[model samples]
Target: MPARRQAPVTSHIWASGGRHLWPSGEASALQSHERGHLVYAASGVLAVHTERGTSIVPANRIAWTPARFAHHHRAHGDTDMRIVFLAPSLARLVPAHPTVFLATDLAREVLLALTGPRNSDYDQSARSRLSRVLVGELREAQEQPLQLPEPHDDRLQALAQLLYENPGDNTSLAEHGRHIGASARTLSRLFHDELGMTFYEWRTQLRIYHALVLLAEGRDATQTAFACGWANPSHFIAAFTAIIGTTPGRYRTN
Candidate 1:
């Protein structure tokens, strides 16, 4: 998510789960599993990119990827990623699509236990029980607004790429429309119909995504605010807190 760094992406796989240690910017190859799985960032942050959208997984959130959905993962900082694959029966309890969920204390503990290095210590019955508890915990947790939905239209895709490439770009939607050969009114309709949000709302989410990455990289709130196109740091803090459920400074500390 930030500048790419040279560090090996180390993965340890077992029967039902595994753990990965990735350096900042380390990314996994695009691939899909036969089973749905939950991914949690024990440290740092992970951006799970799929055709549907990108779900940002911070320490306080967990991401679910449905079976066979092509996706990849990128670390925003030195990240310890824990993953636990679910059997069809267990997966049915969660959403069928890729989603980010608020991680309660119980859910976090369950995730860590499922993917811990000594997971082998748990027998089959014990593992299955833990898996059930983990899924049950997540099933009740609230879905988070950490996902940035991707647009399908070619014009919208182009515009999205432009903003993605430079999140600090302050160009208005109308100006972006002209540059992409579409009228602002047309783009607005497409956004509402296809993406279910206004241009400004989508842009704000995109900026929040970038802000999370910047914060993960240890940047201060003020710096991350400006880097993500917020002219006023206070406004950025408010927007971030509203969506992320925590202020940037507190988020960093946590």
Candidate 2:
């Protein structure tokens, strides 16, 4: 198992937060909070893992975990992670479930200010105002398709683990079905019904998740592309950009 990153201490108040430095591959233990919170990676990538699936939080995005959702954090590189707990009043503004939102310039600045060293200088009212602004910015920001939802069906779960264990596996749904005792059409239907996505779409998300971890570990775009099962680097780049809002090469630099 990877070493654990320093977990955010539990806080039930509005705008309570601090920054933590995490080395590559570090992870936090699974836990839930009484209050909803936001996580931002000032640098590197943070993967927020829950039973539902994982949400990728790169520098340009922020991830929200609703109250009582069991989750863990994993650092993909030398990560500067910031956390901010929202009081119920502010939390009510966001979605009831986990989500990833684009970190606009204003939102990023607000987050940094809330978690930065100067946070201690603010009084409760000032902090509350800033927290509201942060939430407002997020309200205006676009929700990202960075989440990989897990499947609940037995065969789908088994198949998910198989592909997860080896993201480079390029086997078609037919081959997977043959190995797992289900027909290709059956598996396709299960994927759509249980996971709300096609097999290929889900596989692309899994591959991109793997690609992110590889790129965070300093792997180049071409190497990460092939390793994650993309035969053509151009396709990999396009897919990565579409989901992550940046090229793999560019993501590596920031």
Candidate 3:
């Protein structure tokens, strides 16, 4: 709603297997709909952002966003995305929060079949059975650590916002604490107590989230490393691989 002016709109399209079969959105677009739906990429990468955190979705990973949750999707490279709406009952079967699942072969096939226009050829019973299988596959899907949880503390929130806006700022915790009216130790405790991670860990997670977006935009990994506050490209690579399970160079589209 409200014209969604700030970010590029996610064009609803799915291009799979070297064939662009339907309409699709462009890169870095943000949009949402009311109904609960599952988003899968047939090619390239997708990043889903919500209040909970951000999830990086490669082609083999499926992303789910529940109904009425205001989420934004960004495409990395020339991505082909598929959106399938779920009935209210079926939607309840999945987690209410945004989730990422490892797409199994069966799950992927059922998904493509369900989203494709040829599904019109299938009867209701056949369609219903397929839906059930898809949901079952989703239920067993392995979750990924693609999220950067949000903090509730006002001071922590301020610090997070600052880093989010300027990922390249390599400010020490003591320096930030002085500005935020807390000691470095105090904030470090909050990060662990509330967000379950150290200050540096959370910041690295946030930076990687940003790095995914930049890499999705076809930005070079070296450039993305510096842009996202990583002073050393090699170090950034190590951290990124540890979290994302792949190198940033491979994450980008040529």
Most accurate candidate by TM-score: 1
All candidates in order of TM-score, best leading: 1, 2, 3
* Tens digit per residue, CA lDDT, model 2, 1-254: 13355645333233487787887777788899999999999987889988878898988899999999999998887888899999999999999989999999999999998888788889989889999999999999879858889788899988998988899999989999999999999999998888889999999998988898888788999999999998999999999999988998888886
**Residue 6's lDDT in candidate 2:** 62
Score every model by TM-score: 0.95, 0.92, 0.76
Which candidate leads in lDDT?
Answer: 1
Name the regions of candidate 2 deviating beyond 4 angstroms.
1-15
Q: Which of candidates 1 and 3 is the stronger one according to lDDT?
A: 1
Tens-place lDDT digits, model 1, residues 1-254: 23333456888998898999998888887889999989999999999989988899988899999999999899988999999999999998899889999999998998898898779899989999999998888888888858889899999999999998999999999999999999999999999999999999999999998998899999999999999998999999999999988899999998
Off by over 4 Å in 1: 1-7
Candidate 3 off by > 4 Å: 1-35, 43-45, 68-79
Query: How many Å off is the CA of 196 in candidate 3?
Result: 2.6
Better model by lDDT: candidate 2 vs candidate 3: 2
What are the root-mean-square deviations of the candidates from the true structure over C-alphas? Answer: 1.9, 2.8, 4.8
lDDT of each: 0.90, 0.87, 0.75
For candidate 3, list the clashing residue pairs, or say none. 8-29, 11-24, 11-25, 13-23, 13-24
